[model samples]
Target chain A: MIQFTNISKSFDEVKAVRNVSLSIDEGQLFGFIGPDGAGKTTLFRMLNSLLIADEGSIELFGLDPHKDYKKVRQIIGYMPGKFSLYYDLSIEENLNFFATVFGTTIEENYHLIEDIYKQIEPFKKRHAGKLSGGMKQKLALCCALIHKPKLLLLDEPTTGVDAVSRREFWDMLKSLKSKGITIVVSTPYMDEAGMCDSVALMQNGQIHAVESPKAIVDNFQKELLAVKCNDMYKALLTLRNYENCYNVYPFGEYLHYIDKRDSKPIEDINDCLLKHDLQEIEINPVKPDIEDCFIELTRKLSV
Target chain B: MENEQVIIVRDLVKKFGDFTANAGLNFHVDKGEIFGFLGANGAGKTTAMRILCGLSSPTSGLVEVAGYNVKTHAEEVKKRIGYMSQKFSLFEDLTIWENMRFFSTVYGMNKTAFKERGEMLLRKLELFEKRNRLVSTLSLGWKQKLAFTVAILHEPSIVFLDEPTGGVDPITRRQFWEMIYEAADNGITVFVTTHYMDEAEYCNRVTIMVDGRIDALDTPAKLKEKYQVNSMNDVFLALAR
Candidate 1:
């Protein structure tokens, strides 16, 4: 449904996007996973015709965004990373305004956003600026869906949102995807990559890898180990200094450790930590996750 | 060093007109401890944090930070404590060295101390080569690390970080935590607020807020066991939902 061929964009001297080529099938939920300045926003803008790419081309629903800007805008809904809505207007008014701008009415697209809009219906009279972060996010989603566009583009929808609200927002996206709408979203959070049908790991304006979340994790070449001890900071330092240590970083309650070799080398890791006077050492082999894969990919790129 | 309470909040309540942002909060953060403040978007985390930082006054109850009552000793509290948010704490237009000099001067550091610590920090962060570069030219990760170093440049007893890792890459996020760990080891109490549940596990103690009250307060391990969940995210979802 969407395709980009050798797309590249530069702002002044910095290359915001570097020859990125990607495609999203119809009715698929695709995610661009990267941190700020990773070109997710630039690529989105290029797709929506807000910014023209310095090289290559973009096609949405087989229509070139540069040439057919008006038609492309009509068929695609774009929600920016920063909340972009009529803050001075009430929640209901913002929705109505967006609908009218898209040549539709609230009554016409009510079913498309009913599940999400109903939650904020009681406060429809309240100004958008007065709403909290979660409420504003919901209202933004409602506004984005009011026109029933064929494709939805959300840039970093869960960036500053809390964990609970982030999960709810993902669920809302999933429901929208279930309705056969092609959705493309971006986020800095690696864990959210798992929720997408496929995710493009982006960094420094380049796409390093794109695959299903499970496939990405399975493709991790390292034999990962989770190590826990009484003093995690000391243990991390000790493990990083180990002879066979490839990479060791803190992950939640434990430190994710990788050895230079393909083997687990659990006893050697435990011995290294124990020799450093670390106590309560526990080492277990653990499967790599999307965050681990992303880190590994970035490391490979830098190397 | 072992059990000294750096921050003490008892029945802390903050109200905005008729809205109660914080309702009867009672907690204490020990010296050299990493305390995690977590909650939903409107769970009053910011209000409670502001009161502790002496940025905002509490409507009722006592709130002490850095061995001073926030209400009467707001200036004293501000002098002894540092604050940094994800939005940034450094001047974008100034070069890295200039930003450091400005903040150290604002914190009233001696010339000798600022010069000594400033060079040490720049070298440690590997930003010494780019010291003359403008802060606006640095990447988000670099900016956050620089902001963090400058926040603790004054050597405050406690530092308040409001979501310091927001929108940062995975590698830099861990690196930032390493800096926090180093600060705590140096006897600087760290009070951080974050939305990443995995980060909550790194805290020595975490307090989860709900609506306008303290819903759960305990160590990550204890909270996990209490909620019968394996991860802090599940515990947070259980309480906040």
Candidate 2:
């Protein structure tokens, strides 16, 4: 289990994280959702003890990260946002090094990373840098797990990785979680937020909302509508100009708009667009997803 | 000539030493099209893009970009194309205005024309107030938008974007695609590489690469239909996996 109370961190003039608090239950899969400058990385570093918080305290497994970092480092598996694995070293060599550094051998904790390691085992001799993005990611996870750590902290593990590979990686994480490893992952992709048992949406270094994906979606107050027309760009602009429109943005091929009114107002919306002579217009009431909730939540924070 | 082909690659192969980075690739990008180049890392997307951009030579096969043969007219091809890599191709130390001026001149834009267009662009993006701020000071989304605008500053016939939306938030990514659509509307071809499958849906057409070879190429809808899948992500998995 991990807990942060009123934690804050700053670098020069930028307050990366400000007055944030959250508690993660043991063996639970948690996600930190935010954009690039939203301070997800800073919060992860504080938990990893790589960077100390400017204020407040952090407790991991009833131990202070700053005071007991030595034990913290041993039990926590960290895959930084950037690939910190040695590019020149072979995959097998990197695994050996990590295992040995943790005072263990690959054979001792082989079962911990068996599923992931097998994917990259065929290319065990390939240099880490030469491997594909997916292979390197698996290898990194394997290295982080070689010592059989109790917790895993992966920062943006799916960024820059193709969608298929990203799905595969998440599947691997799910399996890892089934083994009772507490996983803390951070990502900017809102779709991935649903994969977590619970998520803490952070923005501008503050935690806007923390809840299950379903809870967040259920909490979305606005009535949602999905509209598709001949010209998507023009439709987006026109929809944004509607009087009752609270938010309108592109979602795949359709422009998902949230109305300020409680009702869907399909007829009024149609009449508004009819005046513009848009073709192939289709408007339907739709359920909001985690992304819609996230956008709505963050918009409120900004305003 | 309604949808003229601006990029053509036939049996294109690129090898380094004994490694074949690109293997017998064939694809064509239409003018004014939003073309998606997608693949797993190490699938040879970068190698093929470099060859098309005239930054590297192909080992064999015919390739043309912007009406010029990449091999024989590398210089000519370079002039008519713009490229922005994932890292955001901008000088971090330079102010926004300075970076804009520098890239326009590099593209051989007239000094007077750049002055007028540069101001207009900054104002349109609402970055005119921060024109003197260092590029590094801007947020990730702002930097990406600026890099994109600079890439097309000269109105190149084709602009190459190598994973332009990596690590950006959803709202910013959507806004960035609006910019891409705007460019395509102006008759400038956009050849972009991205990992987000949702982005592929916005493209006019997409090509998926696997192990140094193109596995699939068509409009997002067509590919999804051909693969009997519901999304581009599923289509890519069907081909690449």
Candidate 3:
């Protein structure tokens, strides 16, 4: 449903996207996983035809975005990274405004956003700005889906939202996807990447890898160890200084450490920490997740 | 132990007309501790934080920071505390050095001290060469770390961070928390609010606010064990429910 061929975009002297090419199948939920300056926003803007690419080409359902952006927008729903709803308008008023803009009525496309709108209907009279972060996101999603668009482009919809709200938002997207709507979401959260059918691991305006979360993680070249001790801060410092330690990062309560030699470096790690008077040291072998894969990929890119 | 309490609150209450934003909130933060404040949206986290930071007046109760009463000495409390919100307070158009100079001057730092500290900070962050570059040109990760450096530049006794790692990548967020850890190691207490459950796990202790009151306050491991959960997210869901 979406295709890009050697697409390149630059802001002044910096290339926001460079020779990137990718495709999204119809009805598939695609995630662009990357950091803030990773060009996901720039690429999304180009797809929406809000910004024109400096080079290469883009096709939306076999139609050139640059040549047919007017009609293309009618079938695509976009929620920008920053909330763009009318803060002064009531929730119901915002929905009505969005429906009217698309030359439709809320009743006609009520099923499209029924599940989402039901969550925010109680506060229909409240101003959009007065709603909570989760409510605002639901209201925004309702507005975006008010016209029953075929595709949805959500940019970091769960950013800054609580974990519960984030889960609910993704569940809403899953329901929408079941209805045969293609969704392209950009998020910095690596955990959310697993929820997508396929994701493009992007960094520095380049697509490092494009695969299912499982496949990407399964391809992790190194074995990982979840390292912890009585004193975590000192453990991290000691692990970083270990001769065979390739990378040491804080992962929740424990540190994720990678070794240069793959042959069960647990004894070596234990000895290194044991020498530092660290006690109760625990090192467990683990599988890499999407965040670890992304970090490793970005590290490779940097080097 | 009593002297270690950098922040002490007793029955703090804040009401917005009829709604009780903070319902008799009470907590104590020890010196050089990383305290995590976790809650659902509109769960009174921001309201309680505002009261602690002296940005909002509580309806009733005692609130103290750095051994000074928040009500009677808001200015004094503000001077000894640094705050960095999710939306950073840096001048985008200004160069890195100019932004540092502006904030230091606002905090009444002397010229010689500001110059020495500013250069040292930038070099440590590897941004010394880009000191003349506009802040707007820096990446989000760079800007976040820089903003954090600026927040603690004045050597405040406590730093209040409201979701300081919002919208940042996982790698960068980890690095940002490293800076927080370094500050706490240097004897600067950190009182931070975060939505990430994993981040809450990094704190020395965490308070979970629900419906304008603290539902639970304890270390992350204890909370998880008490709730029979493996992660802070589950513990939060249990409390919020």
Which pairs clash inside model 1?
Answer: none
Top-TM-score structure, candidate number: 1
Candidate with top DockQ is: 1
Q: What would the per-residue lDDT of candidate 1 be over residues A181-261, giving only the tens digit for each residue?
A: 999999998888989999999999999998998899989988999998888888888888888989999887788999999
Please say which candidate is ahead in TM-score: 1 or 2. 1
Please tell me what DockQ candidate 3 reaches: 0.62
lDDT of 3 by residue, A1-303 (tens): 799999999998889999999999999999999888889999999999899999999999878879999888998899998878999999999999999999999999999988888888988999999988899999999888988888899999988889889888889999999999999999988878979999999887999999988999999999999987877778888888888989999887788999999699999999999999999999999888888898898898889
Q: Is candidate 2 or candidate 3 better by DockQ?
A: 3
Model 3 lDDT tens row, B143-183: 88999999999999999998887667778888998888888
- Tell me model 3's lDDT, rounded to 2 decimals: 0.90
Kindly report the TM-score of the first chain in candidate 1. Answer: 0.98
Distance from true location, Cα of A149 in model 1, Å: 0.8
Tell me which of candidates 1 and 3 scores higher on lDDT: 1
Docking quality (DockQ) for each candidate:
0.73, 0.58, 0.62
lDDT of 1 by residue, B60-152 (tens): 999989889999999999999888988759899999999999999999999999999999989999999999999989999999999999999
Candidates in order, TM-scores: namely 0.97, 0.93, 0.95
lDDT of each: 0.91, 0.89, 0.90
**What is candidate 1's local distance difference test score?**
0.91
Model 2 Cα displacement at B50 (Å)? Answer: 2.2
Clash numbers, per candidate: 0, 0, 0
